[model samples]
Target: MKRRFLPVAVAITASTALLLTGCGSSGGDDDSLGKAKGTGGGGEDASAPASPSPKPAGIKRPEVKLPKSFQVEFAGWTNSDPKLQAIMDDGKERLLASYAAIIKGDPQHSALAYYSEGDALRTGTAWVKGFSDRDLTLIGKGRVYQPQPRISPDGSGTLFYCVDEGKGSTKDTKTGKVTATPAGDAFVLYRTKLRKTDEGVWKTTMVQTERRACK
Candidate 1:
């Protein structure tokens, strides 16, 4: 043989040493680079700030409202899970109050408490788009669609049951006013959704009706 193979062993060990030194140098540079940014990717710097959380752009959500009767199904969620419960809860309160407001014939004032700024803007701009304001006033004032003699929901939205007087306006009131007879009307219930805003609290949503249809 030309010589013993021990020379190969020496070469291998030398290369290993160089590789180890290079790796050590690179690792040290990485640590220093992280330190320059004051990051805690790998350091004892407790001063490293925690990651910032995202802010919500809209009102938070609240809790779910179980339908009191066969009326309305009040339920939902917001894109932001963190604040959805609160938002839904607020919405429920507003929705319940909305009926009371309408019953009192002061929907505008009720709107303040029941809807968010965004909702009010839409409700105002629509000016009864989905609603026949005149009919609403007619039936609403007649108390045919009474919200309730009184409301009794907690901070959440209200659940109200009412009897509509089916008689037309041609009948006479106790006086000559011609108030119709108190015909048996359908029993109805409703639930409102509420939310919180910068100006104050509001009902961002509303759902109402008896689960069972009017006979």
Candidate 2:
């Protein structure tokens, strides 16, 4: 999901500002963690299922529905630790919820709010609004891969991943015109922070995306 409004470098800086506002004074922490390498490729398609998967006995998960025109895949995201795996799963859901909001032309979509809070919520809302304001929507396929997740001693967590947008494009909502995105802008690296709630759902609190940061 590259935006056409600003240059990539400028957008990266602005997005960082939006997501890192309250990330604490320990500025070096994120830099060090960002260097960790992740491994993964190919993921299950993100098309909505006819019936949602059964929820775990005691946990509550939101149902996310996306139009068939848009698809996302998460590759090699398994973790040996169930807790870490849960974080990755929710992070994937959070991203889908955001894209769903954009495609639906709703900046304040409830599903998006369900998986996000704090800086992530605010910035995610604004990002969706950008497309809606321009009467734009996305179509085609997107891939998220190479996820590296870590949990802190205090229960908070961070995830780093790469996104491939080469097969995705933006469409005019009213005019039905599709614009191909540049190959150079198709790859991005993302870093996000999350926390688990009492209900056992992990919600994203912050995010940072760097264009051309991945191959």
Candidate 3:
């Protein structure tokens, strides 16, 4: 199975095979990533369970620069809790950063800015490695929407969202040939678990994914 996050770094076996598209979320059937472990606090100390010690520079995140041709829509999504909204907002930001990293084939940049030491981080690492190993680059367009979040009774945060990967292609850096990405009948659904680090920043610890008919 291909690992999906911004995109699966699966090596392109055929000239027709495309790499990952959209943002970070693993691919598979109801396969979940990461574990829930949090003691919740605000501002510095929310970084969490097994994160690395503070580096001299601090956790690096991306500035998120989207292509002007790109379009993103929320699609009838809203949240009532101000705090939850903030967290969700951060989650989307991280997703955007993830997308940038995958498209750029720079998982290290993403590792520093987003994702902690967990399944999410692992998935991101694999994707970057896979693509680099094959000397392939993913090219595609996508939009996100329909994000709904649930707060655990213990106050742990979880989120569900969708990514629509439109038409695109993958290019072989070696041959400089472009292969059209296979068209999909539906969008991909993503389930993510979130935790605040000791620094009070929300980070994705785990991600689960599956494909379903677009509504």
Residue 168 of model 3 has an lDDT of 43
**lDDT (CA) per prediction:** 0.29, 0.74, 0.52
Which segments of candidate 3 are over 4 A away from where they belong? Answer: 1-61, 67-78, 111-113
Off by over 4 Å in 1: 1-82, 111-114, 120-215
Q: Model 2: runs farther than 4 Å from truth?
A: 1-17, 20-28, 38-54
Model 3 superposed RMSD (Cα): 10.9
Clashes of 2: 2
Best by lDDT: 2
lDDT of 2 by residue, 174-213 (tens): 8998776678787777888899998888899888776777
lDDT of 2 at 23: 53
RMSD per model, one decimal: 32.0, 4.5, 10.9
Error of 1 at 80 (Å): 14
lDDT of 3 by residue, 56-171 (tens): 24755545664543334444344678667756766776666665665566767653356444666666565556666666665655555666676665555777766555444555
